[model samples]
Target: MNVAVSNNTTQPAPRVIKHRAWGRFKRNKMAVVGLVIMVALILLALFAPLIATHDPAEQDLLQRLKPPSKEHWFGTDDLGRDLFSRVLYGARVSLSVGIFSVLFNVIIGVIVGSIAGYYGGKTDSILMRFVDMMLAFPQFFLLIAVVTLFKPSLFNIIVVFVVFGWMGKSRLLRGQIMSVKNREYVDAARTIGMSDFRIIFVHILPNAIAPVIVSATLQMGGMILSESTLSFLGLGIQPPFASWGNILQSAQNLTVMTKAPWVPIIPGFMIFLTIMCFNFIGDGLRNAFDSR
Candidate 1:
């Protein structure tokens, strides 16, 4: 130390940030529970083929409307397909739609918001006005209208969701960027002759992304619920594809509602459980990112 030795023990900034965030997240009990449930659900979905006892789509007239049993854990659906298998397979579809839709939504939102925020005046005004117009529209009705224009499928559902969902995220990021773009580091990047795109994407986004991450996590739950709604309405994932929504659609029948109530209850509870988990996780992340 007397010979002017350099200290190399300090953690890097990114590592420090990740560690702090994880540490804070771990302290939140509800968040940890949500994380555990979500991880289990994802694993089940991923290994559906190996874990599922019967074919999701296999139809047997005689076995229809049976309650939970040793052979069929969740019981048979109206069509006699195993509810357990269908739920597992449906997880794949529902989770994929939610994840992909949010991913694309966030990507588009970040780009749009960064441009609008980094370059103020005319650029910001025009982009923000467009966002406002989008916000004025009734989002649910818009989603229904657009989804109806295309055939109902997984890819199509995600596409329609992304198209409608990005506006809110863009608005959130725009505000964050506007607040942070004038920071010393951003100014430092600009003074060094960095390209506008690089400065915005590399320097500005990393700092401004906390809110977006929280928003995206919360939005995923809504995305899954919306997909389920569309499927129930017969405008999302079609028959033969086991979605939680489509499974609940059977409850619309008076006979099924009274006779095979578990069919609807299983998927309904799953949807509720997943949404609650996402909400808890979002709350944890929001608290973790709060500097105060």
Candidate 2:
């Protein structure tokens, strides 16, 4: 009886950490719903070439300002462009802006942060001061100024956002790396004469990346909003290319709003829902990654 009890006690527990994380995420009903909605939106955007009925840029002045009907689902805009088609196509622009801007920021941030944190002296001070200098500037004004100087192209918008967007992330990642660099594994790697480059990239970065991933997720939504704001202000994506922001810009006239409220309403709702979904997913990811 004693031997059997000892054997039972010594039995290894079933491995369930991944399962637990997944279970926790699944249990968060809001997160699950957000995930589903986001996935659906992505699919809708991806297959838009097949699904969208009208050419996004085609204008039919004769059909201009028509209300939603069997022919044009979300109604026609001032130029008689299909609002539904524009909105569907706009998703691609908005999502691309968000994704590319975030990617650019993350790359720059991770590299700067890893170097600053791992080296930790004059390098850290100089890098952090630069980050501070960036923060001191009014982000929106700076972005507008930059975009105005360079022609307002989609690529230019992405670049401008990336330039301003990296500072906060760099600071966050610096703090995370500072905490992680002091771990025993890192010290052991150093002791074993691992090249600093290898140690930082192979060891430190993987551990530090989790928080950065969460931040990136949240930042994506902000990037989308920023892009929309810029586009609404007539400085992003340009005409012939529709985005939710550009759609809103077209509907800015009071008369237009009164006559064709759905013009702004549909795009506005999409922006709101997309951002909310990203935020919820980011929160859920943060909780999942929290070691405690």
Candidate 3:
């Protein structure tokens, strides 16, 4: 009964289980395309003054409702505002609101969530209850009310968004911190007499930031859309400052939508494309970061 024991005794140490998230992200073609498009859009927005042929706010009723032609690529709006220029400038407003609002949300969320999860006592209960109370309200309606109370401007829009946006990130970060706080390294850090702040910020946050980055990307898209919605409702980035939403707002009249369809069409398409790109890239990031 010579049961031959196989000679492959070394089990290769499980290959160290490295997670190359960036490598995986690079491999996703849609993600790469989305990133490229986003970069191009940002560049266009930044260079709008140099690149745009005419002033976005300049209106010539004589040229109103002109169809797409060699001279005007996207054609002219009802007021004969240069569609291309408005779209380009709109990018600045939209991207600014999205980026800055997300920054505010992330900062507040990380601080609150870190404290709550690290302490895990009355602080957690109090903070979570506050979060829950906020969540109970209808977000968009609340934003609309708040923005209506303040003067309609880019700054006000960003402030309203940040006020509402932090809750979601806070909940997410709290969950992540809870999971990480029980890990061996966290315990070891505490055992070594590391301060609570040091343990949370140094040991835990680095590991927890993967999800935060992914969430932030998706949140950016949402914030952009939210700003656009507010503008469409005539409560964000008022006239003299072109935004996709304000452009679309002009199309509310059915007659204008039919005669000067390009007014809304151009900006609407840009918004759609921008959001889709962000969503694709966000999905890729999420997949790349997932450990399972």
Candidate 4:
């Protein structure tokens, strides 16, 4: 006291939200398993050549419709392409569609929703009404119409997905922003002369984004399924590109479906497993974000 000697005590570093979220996420066993499976699949996709036994697109009519064996692993498809290699490559295509499409959808949603929610006047009404109009339309039907009007190329398919996909996200983000805009920090940011953009983007969006993150994880699986459905219907990725959807299209043939079930079964199983894993991860994230 007399000396007033310095006692240099370092303050603890603040905990990051992601750190806490991860901690919560680790507590869920099923989610951890799903994460492991998801990572493995991604690795398979990344190192397709290294792991693959044969060319995915290489054809052998003699080997076609063969069931799983030690030599061929997953066996050959109707085109005599190695199912194992095709599955790995298909993972690459399917995941690419799911991830890239979501990126664009979220970006559009964030911009539109932030503008409408933060402004909250005639802008909000107009935007919300437009969202409602979109919501009234059947999304699958709309996607079909758009795809039918354009080529079934991968880029066009992704565009159709984005066009229909962003609407729900916009509505979600708008509601989140409306809830967060009236909060104390946002009001304080405004009072401190922060730009409207800064207040909206930095202060409001960050705080309200937990739900969006959960929604995005869940929607990724849905996106994959949609892409698969489109491909199966011959409205997505075309021949020469291996996707889970196109892979399953072999099952559309009654004889192939019944006689050579492996063609559809393997890809179908992969689709189901991937979607379940994604859903598990989504549930984990939701729980983590929702926890106090």
The candidate with the higher lDDT, 2 or 3, is 2
**lDDT score, candidate 3:** 0.85
Candidate with maximal lDDT: 1
| C-alpha lDDT score of every prediction, in listed order | 0.89, 0.86, 0.85, 0.84
Which run of 10 residues does model 2 get worst, by summed lDDT? 6-15
lDDT per residue as tens, model 4, 1-292: 3112211122111246678788999999999999899999999988987998988888999997888898789988877888998899899988878888888888888888999989999999998899889889999988988888888887887888788888778889999999878765566667668999998887678767778778888998999999999989988887788899999986688877877888899999999999999999999999887746
lDDT (Cα, tens digit) per residue for candidate 1, span 1-292: 3111211222124556668889899999999999899999999999999999998989999998999999999998888999999999999999998889999999999989999988989999999999989889999898899889988899989998898899988989999999988766666666668999898887678778889999999999999999999999998899898999999986688888889999999999999999999999999999888766
Where in model 4 is the C-alpha error above 4 Å? 1-15
Candidate 3 lDDT tens digits, 1-292: 1111211221111122124677788889999899999999999999999999899999899998899887788898878888888899999999999889999999999999888887889999999999999999999999999999999988888888888889888888898999878866666667669999898887688767668878889989889999999999898989989999998997787877888787787888888988888888888899887766
lDDT score, candidate 3, position 37: 98
| Model 2, runs deviating above 4 Å | 1-23
My TM-score estimates for the predictions, one after another, are 0.93, 0.90, 0.91, 0.91
Model 1: CA > 4 A from native: 1-12
RMSD of 4: 5.2
